[model samples]
Target: MSETTRSDVIVIGAGMAGASVADALSRDCTVVLLERESHPGYHTTGRSAALFAPVYGPAPIRALTRASAAFMANPPEGFADSPILTPRGALFIAREDQLADLTGLHNELQSEGNFKELDDSGIRKMHPLIREGYAAAGLYDENCQDIDVAALHQGFLRRARARGCSLFTRADVIALEELANGWRVRTPVGTFEAPCVINAAGAWADELGQKAGAEPIGLVPKRRTAMQIAAPAGAKIGGWPIAVDVAEEFYVKPVAQQLLLSPANENPDVPCDVQPDEMDIAICVDRVERAFDLRVGRIETRWAGLRSFVADKCPVAGFSAAVPGFFWLAGQGGYGIQTAPALAELAAALVLGKPMPPEMVIEGVELSSLAPERLSA
Candidate 1:
């Protein structure tokens, strides 16, 4: 039998959520991060074509995202070699039938961002590739931007390691048992014990929770498929913002010399390395061609990623109601990357029993809103 290891905290999953929280928690606690995969972020984090849309997701998420923008715009010295955020606006478009949805969304987020409502002419002017007769209106969010996912993710891991946190790959938890003062986690590598165990296992969060006797959060990992297609020759697409269907049926965004397209599918799936469905790819092409003045002659690449969510569509954070010393940190949906910085800070503070940070307070973070008990009730 392997000798039992100990740490102040054990964070499972080593992806953005685990790494960022480990970075924050490592400031005062000895942290040990574990990932089942051979490498951290080999799953959803690495597959994500990430963007920072402050007005995205539900209220809690938007609040967290707003709280995160400052750090991403200006991270600490040595956090990363390159800037984490680059300007890349977002445009939510609507057909005539969906104009009311666009109007309602605009009113809801008017104060959340630098927003402007555009008519069809205005929409076409902003995104010339959009079919002239397709769009009836648009809501432009100028504050949205593309995220340097790799740098931000690596920076968190680097900082955590520098702060004396240990990271282990191929550490797939097989069993979890609660001791009088802490919890024991058995994995392929060996056994680890910590006073606090954070379940940030992404799609497998609920499964891990079961092993630890924690309450279920009803996390459903939904598959979102995307594909890359070549851009037209001589098209200056760099300045074009991501064009999203206001109804969220599909969307297209420029990625270097190509355009990334997706049907915005939310098919529920189990925890695994999900792949793009042929039907989803076909739907993507149909939607993109119908919305834009372009044709999908060939798809350069295609893949799928899981965006887990609970019933409320808000992220779960805080101690388990059913199990002591076990924390729940999952269900970020597609907004995980954008909201990581602030969410991690919030989770770390909660874990250490510290008062909520002023940053979160200023953003109107409801202390009990993200608690695991909320879902239990």
Candidate 2:
């Protein structure tokens, strides 16, 4: 509560990653978590379309997701009350022209592990919204599910609090400086000192590093828009599988009474309150109509958010070779929600010099793949 306080570690964002890191570290050392927003998950964390498809994304991301699946499937012994992931399979649609691309993707994912390929009938059975126009269909890993992001985040916070860690909301960090023994961060609330700083500031991660005089990591915040509509024609959204275009052009999923869809746009943006562009929504509806038999009706609501990514889109974790005591935990892309469990634990392990948790350190997660050194190399 003093103008400047000391802690064993300071986390620069209270979203999923920061909260999880704080929770992991709190058991061994005092942790201080700072959030710029009025509340946690107010930014991209709250805005995510919480899907946990282990086989989704590029190689490293998929690996991280696969590693995190066990924890998500069973959490820890006493992590939470209800299950974190609910059963919800995902379907990928392929138009006649897209069959080749879909085939290649299917083969690629299948080579990785558990994702299976489903026939056209299987896709329709899972997502009835598919119309007579599509040529073929594919199925991804059956273990995909909707993640209860808020509950998982709150669970981490609860654990951190129980371990005597401190959290400061609306404490936007404005500056970071290196000291003899640690780092000094200036925030809206006050200055705090920590032996190490975790840059989990989401979209503003690169800015945080810049404030501390660290080299740029090429963090880019890409905009993604989603809108809700009346369930497509005869589609009942509650249990429908997530329907995605084979080209990653657009995607749809059942939320409640209505359906959620997106055009998968990736325009560069700065961190802010993201709003859906009218053009983007229209394009999404057009693409949906083109792929399926559904007539786009009313758009009930729409929102947009930034999915921050590094140059290669793989997450940056581990200590910076240039900046002493600075760690990178950003560029999660859109996989943050699903990969949070493993990514956070990985960050903690690297910082504390502890043995890597077996489940998360799979094929491509070596330090070289995600180290800050890669930026300079």
Candidate 3:
């Protein structure tokens, strides 16, 4: 038998969720970060559209994203070499038939975002590529920005390492058990035991929970496909804001000279290295051509990733009621990157039995909603 390594906490999955929480907890606890893939962020963390929209997601998620703005705007020194967020406004478009949905969305986000509803002329003026008469109305948000995902993710891992957190990539967890006073994780590398375990396994979060004799969190992994295409006829897209359908059927964001398109699909899928489906790509292309004046001559690049979610769509970040010391930190869905900072702080406080961060409390983050017991019970 290989020698057993021990730590105060064992964090499963080294993607953004695991990395961020590990970084936060490393300040006061001995943490062992384990990744199943050859490298961290091989999945969703590296494949996001990488936007920071404070008005996005559920109320809990919006509160978390709002709390994360400070960190995104001004990360700790040496966390990242470049600015973590860059200004890139967002424009939500609505067809005549979809105007009602747009109005409801505006009402819901009026207090959450720096935005305003626009008329037909305004949508065309803001997004020149929009087909004339296709969009009946729009909402322009000036506060949205592009999140530097790589920098943020790498910074979290680097900071955790500097704080003495040990990250072991390719440490595929085969088994997990809650010990009398701790937890034992069996992986290819070795047997690692810790006083507590955090299941940040992304798509496989529920699977990991079952291994630890904990009740299911009802996690479901969904497929979302994205592709890159060249800009239209030498058009300058550097300053263009992301254009999205009001109902979220599709979205197009300018990335340098190229445009990134997605159908905003939520097709249920099993955990694995997900790939873009041909049908999804076809659907995305159809939507893009109808919504915009541009033509997709060729797909510069295409990929797919999984977003895990539970019933409420809010993140789960508490200990299992049936299994002591087993923490649930999964079900981030598509909001993981933007919400990582606040979630990490909240997770650390929960792991260490500390009070919720006052800043998060001020932002109206209620802890009970995120408790694992809500799902397990």
Candidate 4:
């Protein structure tokens, strides 16, 4: 390898999770943030639907999102030129057979956020485009909003840079060696050493663990495809809520002068630069047509991204029990962006051997739920 540069910590990956954690750690540690891509957030982070819905994920994820709500609502001064979140509300619709599911979700999320049950007519009133017989009941969360994903990612990067964190792009880690005092990481561009190594490689998290001789956490990367289509003629969609099926078969939301659609397909795949499958795109079109009165116009754009998950479907954070100084910040699934703030704070606290931040504690975040050791051998 070449001459070694040194830092207090090395973080692999520059997506939302990686950047947020790096920013939090940079306040105290010298951090080297590495990205295999030419730019940060060129993968999943850049392709996110960017919804800040606290009631969107599992219990642990919901807790993290709730903890992050304060930060998203009132970010640090000068973090972004504009607000990170805007009113966009969300409506989870269900057919007659799926009405039970909608009710269950409404009840389950009531403790976490404000969720109200709406009958078919009520749902249609909120979203007039929804076709009759497609939605028997729905769960509405008015607090849910659209997130400025790029701005959020950039804010984390800005904070990290301002705190003296070094960012290196196009630096693919080729080798990782654990030394008694630290880790030596070799990338194609250069070599660097750090006392601690954070595996924040998103879909490639388990691969990085194996490279470092750490125990595998069974991370699975699933592909999700999204596309935009022309809006219906003369339709006023600005006040339209994001409409999602209770079974997760499909979701449609109004964007500026266009409509965004997703089939919510979760096809298992290896880590890669993903592209939307033709069949998946067809499925999305069919579902949207059946669910709404609008016609599917020309596809403006389409793309796919991977959402990584552990077997237990919870985020993995904290130091690895099998590898000294190896920390995990992976398996966030689709909740990474919405829950970034709290997860970053938790990871920072665990890595620095400090207590959980008061803000996180007040939001009832349980560190044990996201600890790396929770994933079994």
lDDT of each prediction vs. the true structure?
0.92, 0.85, 0.94, 0.91
Q: What CA RMSD would candidate 2 show? A: 1.9
Model 2 clash pairs are none
What TM-score would candidate 1 get against the native? 0.99
Q: Which of 1 and 4 is the better model by lDDT?
A: 1
Clashing pairs in 1: none
Displacement of the residue 146 alpha carbon in candidate 1, Å? 0.3
Over 46-79, each residue of candidate 3 has an lDDT whose tens digit, in order, gives 8999999888899999999989999999999899
lDDT of 4: 0.91
Off by over 4 Å in 1: none
Tell me which residue pairs clash in candidate 4: none
Candidate 2, superposed: residue stretches over 4 Å from native: 113-119, 232-235, 362-364
Best by the lDDT measure:
3
Question: How many backbone clashes can be found in candidate 3?
Answer: 0
After superposition of all CA atoms, the RMSD between model 4 and the true structure is 1.1
Candidate 4 lDDT over residue span 1-377, tens digit each: 37788999999999999999999999998999999999999999999888988788788888888889889999989999899999999999999988788878877777766778898899999999999767888888899999999999999999999999999999999999999998999998899999999999999999999999998899999999999988888989998999989889999989987899999999999999999999999999999889999778789999999999998789999888888999999999999999999999999988999999888888778887888777783
Candidate 4 is scored at a TM of 0.98
Instruction: Using TM-score as the measure, name the better of candidate 2 and candidate 3.
Output: 3
The digit string of per-residue lDDT tens for model 2 on 8-115 reads 999999989899999988988989999998899988998888899877888878888887888788887678888999988777778777889887877787766466
Better of 3 and 4 by lDDT: 3
